[model samples]
Target: MTSNFRSLPVIALLTILSLPLVVMYAFTLVDSITDAEPGSLIPSEFTFHHWRFLWDDTTGRGSVWIATINTFIFAGSTAAIVCATSLTSAYALSRLNFPARRFFLAGVIILHAFPTITLIIAIFLILQFLGLFDTLIGVIMVKAALELPFGIWVMKGFYDTVPWEIEMAGVQDGASRFMVWRKLVLPQVQPGLSALLIFSFLSGWSEFILPLVLAPGSDAQVLSTYLAYFLLDDSLEVDFNLFKSVGLFYALPVILIYLAFQKKLMNIYGGGSKG
Candidate 1:
């Protein structure tokens, strides 16, 4: 009772501070779906014309549908590849002692330290040489590779939190090392794994530079690139409503995903194995 009373003021203050931002965002969404006048916050009339392009290729160039599909392919593939390789490599690094293990971990940090732009020229040439230039698969591979260092480090920390006793107990119970890791150890780090997966997916989903530079043109464009077209359109007047609508569309998946996994995400910072 005393603690609740003490926290009431903080909670109230936070609510007060967040209220305007929330209202503004809500109005932004409303502005997209309604026919509002220039510089007017209130809607004059409601219309679905803003969303019409989502279903039909009203824009003679093409709809964002293909780019949406390509985005899913790239983000999904990047997340899966990063998760799989990160988990195994993290487990190995956490549990096994080998030559240059520490050095390799340091190397991962060094690899991620450099801005990706620094390697753009080299990557572009390499992709061109490998016949993967301007391709979705190529982008997926690059995104996965770039995300791997972070994923590996995160998963390694989670793996460190898992008690070795758990693996030993599984081994003592006649479980193979693979089975022990699969059935026993992995479950303990569910929070970190879930966090990494979501982050990797969102990273790929929101990736702009890599896709823009490596896979430019309509054929390989993703949602991030598609959003650019709104600003780059030849129209004399920029349609803020249409741009916001598409922005909302592009953001929906990420919002839904975070909401769906919000509960699990808390476990990321929760206490790890005791021993």
Candidate 2:
């Protein structure tokens, strides 16, 4: 009797939990099938035109190639810079001792919590002063800096979970500090690094505010800006279904990648994030 009662509650809880997801999926499915104007949710019939149209795009206005490349470049460069700067520096903070280390570590974390939007004006002025306003490389550098602090903090926690004695043993064997970290420490934190790469790439990939504020022309524009272009275009009629189609295609690859690696991300960001 007790077992049956417990099972009933468990089943009830699962049904309740699943309700929101079912609703959301139904909404997305309806959105995909509908051909009405941007505001309408109902469709006369199902259509595959949007999906098929992505490949046939020659309008120049809807070219996925350009925006795809921009996204890749931004995400790739940001991940590289974040991993390079954060991995080594964070390892140093975690394993090595120095004066003012705690203060420095706290500041690193505090800076990680700083919102990216708040940096826009300051970054804009700085880039303007350096004569790099609206440059792809400049945006890449800013994204890298934005990613560095959080990446370092995530890595620091991952490093703590690794036994320091492993690196210490390397040191006692006459291995230089640099060599010990490179060969020994890094290998232990590869999972966290992978998670960091995925996350930092996603952030750079999806970030719109900074690039929107900073990108001076199409030369430096990424996917986010390109998406907004459709809404802003006065020359062409706004096509809501086409906009949603483009969005889904652009988002599909990243979504798949995230889903594939989602199970490990919590551990990367949470499970091992403490001293």
Clash tally, candidates in order:
0, 0
C-alpha lDDT (0 to 100) for residue 214 of candidate 1: 92
In order, candidate lDDTs are 0.86, 0.80
lDDT by residue for model 2 over 1-275, one digit each (tens)? 35535587888899899999887656655666566655565666678765544577643555667668888998899999999888988888987898899998999988889988888899999999998889888899998998898999888888888887787799999999889888887777888988898889888989887778888477778888877777877876666666677677678878898899897666685635322
Residue 258, candidate 2: Cα error in Å is 1.8
Residue pairs in clash, model 1: none
Task: Specify the highest-TM-score model's number.
Answer: 1
Residue runs of model 2 more than 4 Å from their true location after superposition = 1-42, 46-48, 51-62, 270-275
RMSD of each: 2.4, 3.6
Worst 10 residues of 1 by lDDT: 266-275
Off by over 4 Å in 1: 1-20, 235-237, 271-275
Best-matching candidate per lDDT: 1
